[model samples]
Every structure is written in C-alpha cells, then in structure tokens.
Target: MYLTAVASLRAGHADDVFLLKRPGWVRDTLKQLDEAKRLSGGELFVARWMSGVVRAQVPGLFGERAAAMQDLVWCLAHADKAPNLGWMREVYFHLAALHRQRGEDAAARRYQTLSGFASETRPATFTTPFSEAPVAGHTFSSRLIREVVPGAVYLLSGFEFTEYYFVVSADRRELIAIDAGTRADAARAAHEALRARVPSLPPLTTVLVTHAHWDHVGGQRYFRSLSPSPRFIGRGNYKDELAHDAMANPAGLQLFFGKEFQLADVLSYKPDVTVDRPTELIIRGTRFELLPTRGGETDDACR
Candidate 1:
C-alpha cells in the first residue's frame, strides 16, 4: 500500500496539468496516502505529513479554505514527528503563506516567526542541493530580485539552483556581478529579468566567482558573449578542482545536478583572470578584496 501511494504521488507530479485542472489526481493521491497510513498502523509518518500538505494545497484547486486550514494545523500538531527540521520549516512557511492569502496578517506573522525559528534550529546537515523538495520561497521558474544595498547592490535569486548578485559601481556606469548560474539559459533569463527590473542597470564590467563548482560557473559562456565581455575572475586552483571533480562518478554528479546538466559546459569553464593569493581589484571605482579559503564544498573558493 505504501509503495502504491508513493507511485500515485509520483504520477500526480508527472502530470503536466495545473493542480486546479486535475482535482481527481489530488483526491486519488490523498486517498492512497490515507490507506497507506492506515495499513502501516500509523507508523508511516511521512505519508501522513504528505497527506496534510496535499490537503492544504487543495483549497487552491477545488476545496474549502477551512478544510485546508485544518489540515495545515494538523501538520503543525504533528511537527515534532517530522523527519527533519527542514520539513517542519516548510509547514510553517506554507501556513504563513496560506494565512496571508486569507488576509490574516497576525496569524501570518506568527507562522513566519515560527518558520524562521525552525530554519535557525535546523542542522547544517539537513541543507543540501539534492533535495527532491523545492526550496522554500523559491520557484525554479521565477526570478526574485532585491536591492541589498539600496541603489548600489542587488541580489538575484531563484535561478534553477543558485543565487547571484550585482553591484553597481560608484559612478553607476558599470556593474560587477557575483557568480553566474547553473546553466547558460538560466543565467540569460536571470540577467534579462534583472535588466527588466532595473532598467538603468549598467553593463556588466566584471564577474567575481566565489568557487569553481559547476553550478557557479556553468553560465560563464553567457557572460562572455557580452560586447567587449566582462572580465571573469576566479581562483587559480579552478583547473585542478575541476580535474578532481572529473574523477567523480558520473552517475553521482547527474544525481545531484539532474540529467539536464552538461558536463562539457562545466569542464570548458575558464576564467579570464585567476587569483591564488590575497589580492585586491578596483573596478570602476569599486574596491574588491579577494581572499582564498578552503570552503566546505571545494578548496578553490574565494571571498
């Protein structure tokens, strides 16, 4: 029964139709999950939690809002039994959004606080790029941009897998970008979105890479296409780091990055400028101090 329920859920996800257009799929999945929970003698906590989540999303499709609220509250009541703090955080975040949608500002704020608490309490080991679940507050198909330093620095998030930033030079005539994205298309889309948002954004003059990870450098080719091109800067050990990763199992890399990932793009990435030691660069009147560090993910990391 549990295996059947899992299969049902996967099929529901595979459907291309919007949830609202497929209420039968949602209802069927919920029924399967409930049966799985019962057959497991209530030992299937993950199934139960997933049922609650499915129920919560039903209001957005074809159900009563009150029913959705009840299921969300039930999920919170069972939060202590969650597989991980990350899952609990997701519940809180979802509840917050639901409350806000219903114009319950106070309840939304309370759940937002709880969500932040869950995030802070979550162990670092729970954080991984390979989670099948989507990141909270981030939609892979959308881009979110925020001005981190009023008019000077901005952050671009919600790329397929990573976030990058833009810093306007002191003269506001050039932009220094921090990191590319996971793919050339993603980078292009993000850049176009950023340009649309900040119509006056300057031309990219420099790109500072923090690491040589595939996700960070896969979009280098897009930046290189700019007229005159931005100067790409990265750690001098970039080649050696890529060489080391090349020895890793191909299946393992595909599992983490998805089958759509291209090894050749990552392998062909090369920065125009490399730094091995402490160095400082001044681009368009903005001073950037680069420091090397042994990052948790890779040795070729800079800040």
Candidate 2:
C-alpha cells in the first residue's frame, strides 16, 4: 500500500494519498506491493514509482552512471510485462535527458544500449530471509528518589507500589499533584515531604488523575481533602466516560474496584482543595507539553 500511495502521490493522485493517511492506511498496501514485487508476474506499480525517481536521478548521477547502470538494467529487465518495460523506457529517456543536459552523450548512449539489452533479458525471481525463532524476554529495575527533578518525583513506600508525580502549581501558593501515590499514606507522606522541602507545608493543594486506572490515579480522595481540597482532572463528561468504560470493560472495572476499595480503606487527608479543568499551573518549573495520543495504559497518555 505504501508503494501504491507513493505511486499515487508521484502520479498526482493527491486526494487518494490524503485519504489513505500514509502511516495508518498505506502500510498494508505497501506490504501488498512488496509481495507483488516478489511474485513472478505480479503488479509493477512500485517499480513504476521507483522508475520515476530513478529516471530523475540521472542528472545527479552524471559521473556515477557506470555505477548505477547495473541497477538500472536490472530494474528494466526483471519485470514481467510490456507496461513495466515501457515504464523502464520512460525512466531511461528521463535519465537520457539528464545526461544530455550534462553534455554526457556517450554515457547516455551507454544507458540506451543497456536499456536495449534489458529487452533481451528475462525477469529473475527474488527472495528474502525470514526467522521463526522465538526471542528471549528481559527485565530491569528502576530506582526510587524524592523530588529528583523538581516537578517529577519518585516516591517509594516499600516496593508494593512506587509512584511518580508531576507537581503542578495551584492557586494562592498551593500545588496540584499529578499521578499521586498508590495508597493514602504514600500520598499524604509525599505531600508532606514536598511541603517540607519547599517550606510551604500547611494548606496543601489538589491532586489530579492521569487516568482511571488504580496505579496511576490511586491517591485520588486522599489528596482531595486538602484545605483547598484537590480536584480530579478529567474530561467534560468524566462521570459518563468512567461509567461507559467500566460497563464496556469488565476486566478494567475489576482492576479499578480493588484499588478504589484499598484506597478508601487507607484514605487520609490534609486541607480542602477545589478542582476545575484547564488547570494551567507550572509544574515545578517544567511546563508540560500536552500531545494527544492513543490511551490504553492511562486515562490520558503523552506521546
């Protein structure tokens, strides 16, 4: 499909190219085109595309024709039909024109001779290698640190679940925590630790959720009881979204239910914090760049 798309684009099929959305839709087509190239008497669409670019390569290949001639002859000879040969001839002509422009008539003549020889030669089969062996799995460990890079901090509460949070500044010298702790104690401890480090302990700020998952958004209510109580950052119709997701995905709902129960059992609070959308606060001096991406692991994912 990629070759087909490339061909279409080269042939001025802009609308077709636009509709295909290269990365998403054209991958399958490109694979098909590759398969066709492998078959003895299949489509030469990709070759046609290559021929256009190849033909246009002559001026650039002025002193390099002798080196490129073999590949050119191969492209011309190793295709199954007349149109393919015709495409090769068109490419040859373009290269010839380029050679003429560069005053290399002898080199042009040499390419013309090779093109004629291509008519006498036949298409040869091509093959690629494949591996069927399974690969081995690997594992690695990550370290825990408190407030390593300002907004980004690693809070470890004895390995059950080590969480990281990106702190966003809140109104009236308060802060909002993004991706709070796994348990209530972890969340409150993290808040206190951050406060102690910053010397602004009381009047704790809000807590936000990256997604509805237990691990990422586990400390929701714990931090929500601050003086200005933290608010959960979610979509416009978050409740509806959450309900739809829970119903549609039973396994996902089960995962959240267990975490929610655990969080509720161990919940602790500081002060009250209000919640609202468009929470445009600087996170520990690092500004978050929001980019839309496919979200499966978290409610919101940054690509």
Best by lDDT: 1
Tens-digit per-residue lDDT, 174-230, candidate 2: 454565555555566656655555564335444554444445444555665565655
What is the alpha-carbon lDDT for the whole of candidate 1? 0.72
TM-score of each: 0.54, 0.35
Candidate 1, clashing residue pairs?
none
lDDT of 2 at 102: 66
TM-score of candidate 2 versus the correct structure, residues matched by position = 0.35
Over 4 Å off, model 2: 1-144, 150-162, 166-172, 196-203, 244-286, 298-303
Stretch of 10 with least lDDT, candidate 1: 128-137
Report residue 18 deviation for candidate 1 (angstroms): 40
Candidate 1 residue-wise lDDT at 8:
47
Q: Please give the lDDT score at residue 176 for candidate 1.
A: 89
* Each prediction's whole-model lDDT (CA): 0.72, 0.43
